[model samples]
Target: MCGTEEEMREVAGRICRNYLHGAWKTVEPQALGFRRISRVARRSVLRSNSFTMDEPKKVLLRIYGQVHGERAMDAIVTESVIFTLLSERRLGPKLHGVFSGGRIEQYIPELSEPALSMKIAEKMAAIHSMDVPLSKEPTWLWKTMGKWTRTVREERLSENIHGKSVDFEKEVEWLKKFIATVESPVAFCHNDMQE
Candidate 1:
């Protein structure tokens, strides 16, 4: 139900009060010294006005939740992992403070377009240098291929589009053969670079 402006303001005030009253005790909000500048579709750009944080720091923050849950304990583990990795490589944001509260990261305001591109390219190169062994286990590959084939089959069965019959087994076989042709010593590849 919709409410008058005053009523809506009261509701918002109540919600904020509840939050301030330790309703979300486990996850305390901490200012990261940054603000979201703009959002276009699914992409968002965050700007930091302080001198300590940079684009890389924001990237680290963005991906933090991917490997970790939103809970406080999970945040601790994730932060530790991030710090360890960053320290090892000597290429991460400076850790300002840590606790049950959210992280306080240093902020950097401006970056030249060319410098940003170079920084991104360097990060990409570093990531691509990491070693990832190709799976030699045939059973796993067969299982994965089987699952994919089944999914495609189900989709085809549901759709009304009728034309030439698709030989799924042949397609799966071709895919398997194609995958086998890929040389080993695979490096981490991030196809999506737009932030």
Candidate 2:
């Protein structure tokens, strides 16, 4: 986390400049012509990373990082991987470049809240309808959940709270069996919608 708003802006600007320059260096001789990014007002659903627009290039840059001890739940998949796939299908923003902890993407201007909702629903349906890549691995949801369940069970057993009889093993087994019975299909989803 940054100590101040100014510090955050400085960091974002550096990242954005590096990304754009690196991406264009080989092809374009002209400088990036970057100006300072104007910070947008934070909303409930927005990530702590400030939204900035490139006036010269007409692009959007998103700087990703930990905020208030919370990190993105991109355990098995990274944003670059997901966004690249979505970009190929023209389902999401066009990715201009990716940095170490952030990415520069084509920015769409925000619409009114109600109109945004409608657009999001339509886009999500379109995204879900796309065929998964033949080379991509299966969804990691179930595997990650099962791993967490075991870890929780181990922690509880280690704590040994008195008068608490918890059969986590049985619970996990039952949960897995229950989940197997359900017809939940793995679809392309923006797991972190708040971003």
Candidate 3:
């Protein structure tokens, strides 16, 4: 529904109103500065997947897709939960609001690459070690990759009618076997790590 930053903020304000209800007046609306901090790529096309809103308060807004579509929405739900938990534990950004396309989160200040990498490693280690209960079963790595693999196959076929077909079932079997061979506890991971 929202096509620009102003529109996005307006939608967020509406959501905040619904979330706060009678208490909405407690917080002041900030004159936010919007920037395309990052984007989530789909089929080689970049989408407004992530944006940073700065000023009185800074927050990272993640836009959600319409449906899971074999596992897409599943990933968002997973990330949202992870963000929520991270906020609660003070491990990641604070979660502000949630809407159709995405949710708002606290904006951590930028750091240099080396510093950022170190912090991320430390934070991820903490997340991995914590015994937190996720809302749903974490979709195993293999399943997530399989979804992308399937999408690639479909696109390949669609692009060229005579493209060599991929043996999806065989690929799935291989993925399962590969995943089975791994001997480590699976942790909730930010599969889409760029943002």
- For this target, which candidate reaches the highest lDDT against the unseen true structure? 3
RMSD of 3: 7.1
Q: Each model's C-alpha lDDT?
A: 0.43, 0.55, 0.57
TM-score versus the correct structure, for each prediction: 0.43, 0.61, 0.62
Candidate 3 local distance difference test against the native: 0.57
- Candidate 1 residue spans exceeding 4 A from truth: 1-88, 91-112, 132-148, 157-164, 167-169, 182-184, 190-194
Worst 10 residues of 1 by lDDT: 41-50
What ranges in model 2 sit over 4 Å off?
A: 21-60, 66-77, 108-112, 134-139, 157-164
Which one is best on TM-score?
3
How do the residues 1-195 of candidate 1 rate in per-residue lDDT, one tens digit apiece? 024534433433332233322231222223222233223312122222224332233321221222332355653565455554543564444444333333333333344378877886787687567543433355645776677678878787523437557777687789878978988643445354424
Tens digit of per-residue lDDT, candidate 3, span 1-195:
346756655655555445433333233334323455555421111112223332224445555545646667766767777778888998776666676666656556564477887987898888878776764454565676777677877776534446665666577788778877988666656544434
Report RMSD for candidate 1: 9.3
Cα shift from native, residue 108, model 3 (Å): 1.7
- By the TM-score metric, which is better: model 1 or model 2? 2
Task: State the lDDT at 121 in candidate 3.
Answer: 81
Error at 51, model 1, angstroms = 11
